[model samples]
Target chain A: MDTCIEKIRTICADLLAKGKVQKVIGFAEGSIPMASRPIAVTSKEDVAKLVFNATCGLNLANYVSDVLPKEGKIAVTAKGCDSRNLVTHMVENQVSRDQLYIIGVPCTGMVDKRKIAALFEDEITDFIEDGDTLTIVSPQKKEKVSKKDVLRHNCRVCTHRNPVVFDVMAAEPVEEQSLDQPFADVDHIAAMDPAARWAHFQELTKNCIRCYACRNACPLCYCPTCFVDESSPQWVGKGQDKTDINTFHFLRAFHCAGRCTDCGACVEACPMGINVRDFTRKLNKDALELFGWEAGLDMEKRPPLDVYSPDDPNDFIK
Target chain B: MNFITIDKKDWTTGIDKSRETYQVFGPVQDENGCQIKPLAPDVHPLMDAGVTVMSPKSVLFPQTQKMLTATLDASIEDHHVMKPVKKDDTPRVVLGIRPYDARAILLVKLNFDNPDYQDPYWCEAYAATTFVGLGVNHPGPCDFSTSTGCGPFSEEGLDVLMADLDDRYLAKILTEKGETWAGACGFDTRADAAESQSLFDILRKEAEKNITSVDTDQLSEKSILDLYEAPFWDDVAFSCINCGTCTFVCPTCWCFDIQDETKHKTAVRFRNWDTCMSPLFTHHASGHNPRGSKVQRVRQRFMHKLKYFVDKYDQGIMCVGCGRCVASCPVNIDIREVCTIMNNYESK
Candidate 1:
């Protein structure tokens, strides 16, 4: 861990001096103990604030599009799943590849904040990491737990142990993890009868206040103009009716069918804790089986719904 | 204009064979009534004229995407990285699209691809997909697009237009893409210019006649702008839960917010769709919200649709009047009723 911290400081100082990047956006040791938050380092003096440990679980890729320097180059670090998001962005034309310097890190997964908080009833004063185990020292008690016990749902099915697209590699690239049981939950839902399925959907959708946190957390939903705002013809209404709620979820699920990467960000971002993952995972399975496609895996491949083959089958249209 | 008549039996085979060359997408049935599914040998029968529970906008702009990725550790060598993805331009076909939806796609093209505004993601998807619009033989419960001047068939962005003329379906080849698609169907009879004109006239008359008797002239862009502070918003928005359902279901709402997700040394930045109806829709990081209340959010939804969009897009009425909101609203707040109320209020 000490060696990793030293390496980060040396590289940041060198990058700033060489003019390779104007700014480096990374995590700094937060003022509060055990809390790691996003920080931007412009000069070598700020390098000492950088830290990477078990508690550093927030995906920093979310900040790059907003903070990265446009004229000069910018440098950022990434973990296995984080690299996939970069690949997804490159695939969707959100940011330019030439303007970025990627430092890929092999991850052993990170802890979920909600789970950690639930475990520690009191506020954590300090935290220490020893290999894969995290020891939390709170004002009242000290607790030690394996990082695997509190891993986020996203890290469980992580396929890309190595950065799919990166410039400079930091740690030794880990082998891809198996995701054979990825759709088990979706399959279980699919096994239910139509009435049961509808009941389940209705129950889940009824809880939707239509905050669109699911939509906002998604990476592929980058439309400058969306259909819900059209007024000339007013395709849909502007009230909180059950039918309207159904339409919102139904359309949202369909729209995300082939494009959803199943990062679980939508589920995590939901304040109501609705099972939005079921819909996305179901669509993911459909896209994989029907179109033989997987989103966020290959940057070169086109989304299944976007392009068509002349020999494409359409026996269902009759 | 080119028209061809195929027996109902031959129609399926012709379309099936023609679809073989293009990636085909159309409506399909799930546990729900209907949705636009990928066209396949087993699912082609799902293309009948029925209102899909969901719109086809997903074919262009998706719900989630990764915009960029980064690493926070500076000493890890290569740090901040930006990677942009390219959109696919493969030719495909959308079969069994209602006239209003076909028109809606055209509107999307106009709004998304304007010189002043360009949405590359939508453009790429639209460019790749050929629209094979199927005219509605029966308008469903919620379809009010015909009243708004969008009807059975539109040449706005169609590759091929198929209209059900009683027993036989008239296949009109509109664009060069449609002509090429028609050529692949092994039917050589070209639709003459006269036939095309007659078809247009018939469609226009039918649409105008079916339109709901609403005085939209009074609800112009000017009137909508003036009504921003009207008490009607409070009355109408009373039932609104600020769930963003209207913006999500409407075929034209298009606001978004960007966020970052980071873990360990890595980070990813992405954009997701947002709606004006939510309290946080216009909330900035500084804790100030532009559209803070239900009334403001609701007002913004209608104002953007009726006034702002039209003001920006040159009389471009963003709403296609699909009435999905009317059917879906839990409070049963029909947009048509709201428009009528607004029209009446302006009159007095």
Candidate 2:
């Protein structure tokens, strides 16, 4: 991990010093334990702030669309999931291929901070990831745990461990694991009766304060004026009413029907800890089953919804 | 003022008794995390449920509320006339609310219950509620209430502040409202006021010592424009994704946006929780946004909490140091560090 971090820093410094890019968007040491913040560096001197670790869970491509300069290129540190989003961004014309310098890192997995916080009694003073083991230090004592135990739910089932696209590789590509059932969680929900499914979704989102963190965190949700904000013909009422709340989640997830990359940024960003990915994952399952398509796997291929096929499923259109 | 001792054995009975008269809300562990929720008929407040993921501010100022409604039918005589929504002013009691959170409500009151313009919904809900605060024996790592003119055991906004004493609770009934509610619950075992005060003092001091962090003393004296134009804001705003998580979980953030939604024949106006972090929060009708830049919006949040609110209200600051934002920020953009930078800034 240290070698990877060093390599990222060296690449960023070189890019900036030689004026290959105007800025390098990367992760820096976070204020809290087991967290890394997104940092923007324009100078070689400031390139040391860039870090690479298992804790870097946020999709750096979320910032790429907003930060990419009009003229000069900008370097970005991207994981496998982030690279997928960058590919999606290019396919959607959010950013140009010429304006990006992709520095891709192979991700093993990211540890869920919320889960880890609940496991520790005291504050985690320090954390070190070595191979498949994570050593956590607290005021009380040091404890070692398997990385598999703390890996985020999305990362646990991830099939993409290596970047789909990269101009520069930070480290050796990781072996991708094959999953027995990719949509096991979604299937479990689908198997439920309609009434039971409704009850489950209600209970899951009952505590949602409607903060919109999930929408803001996703790389795909980059609309200038979201449907919720549109007043002329308000799609969903901005209130805590059950119907309003349910509508907001349903529509937001529907908008990303075929575009969602399953990066888990939405779930990770929710303050209420709402597993909003379930709603999005169900859409992923539908796209795969109905259209035989997955998002962001290839830049040349358009999203399932973006392109219309004469043979496309139209059972519900009537 | 009198202090009442509530026995551990009769805690449930007392709470149950109060449930008959008041709408009781308290912290309960859900699938997401511990949250302050209105207790159902069967469920009771989890007294030992630690710091809730979301603050209890929603109890008085809901995340979304209906302010008024109107008839949209043109055939009616009084059609299109707006009418104030009738709000339920039923007596409510919030049990086991943290002292810092309770203090945060008071800070919010400075905005909602002010002389210039009173928010009827917030004021009515606030008046109908009784705040029973629970003192923190051990503060969280992010809590710095002591330095921000409040503490774990502070009684500024509480009617009754309860201290955990092993098997029992020492209820320091501070107001007549508290006494009436406690009396209804049969928690009237009187104890010496002076002795109870000393006990509270000891607990307060011990809890305060655990929280050692940034000080905001110099922030009150600092020039607002100078701090606003400071170079650190760009860096601070860098990692910020402009998400509403920090503002939503925050107990003191009281900004709200109002909109009217009309059905075929019924029109309803709702006020929902809004954050300055959103670009649309400041977007003008003509689409001209004065705070269009992310840096300006980010700077506005901190400046309003630390400088603007202090100068406007002559209050300490708009924060109660509950540290919900500190703990819940996705990127870990800590307020304590930002405060330290502003407080120590020499205007260079």
lDDT score of residue A255 within candidate 2: 94
Tens digit of lDDT per residue, candidate 2, span B17-75? 99888999999887788888889978888887667888999999988889888898889
* Tens-digit lDDT string for candidate 1 (B1-348): 467654565666766777667777888755323567567765574555356655676666554455567778898667876555544667777777767777777666676788788877777777778777776554544556754556655555577777766565667777887777766656565556677568756865664554454444455535654578676776566434344556655666656666555669878766666777656567576867787666787778777766666667664467777765654442345677666665566523
**Candidate 2 chain A, run of 10 with poorest lDDT:** A116-125
In candidate 1, stretches whose alpha carbon ends up further than 4 angstroms from where it belongs are A1-318, B67-79, B185-210, B221-225, B262-268
Docking class of 1: incorrect
Model 2, A124-147: lDDT tens digits are: 667887877889886667889888
Q: Report lDDT (Cα) of residue B206, candidate 2.
A: 87
Question: What is the Cα-based lDDT of residue A3 in candidate 2?
Answer: 65
Residue-level lDDT of model 1, residues A99-192, one tens digit each, is 7887766777666655675575444556677877788776568999888788766667666656667777656666667876877788888899
The numbered model that scores best in DockQ is 2
> What's the residue-level lDDT of A246 in candidate 2?
94
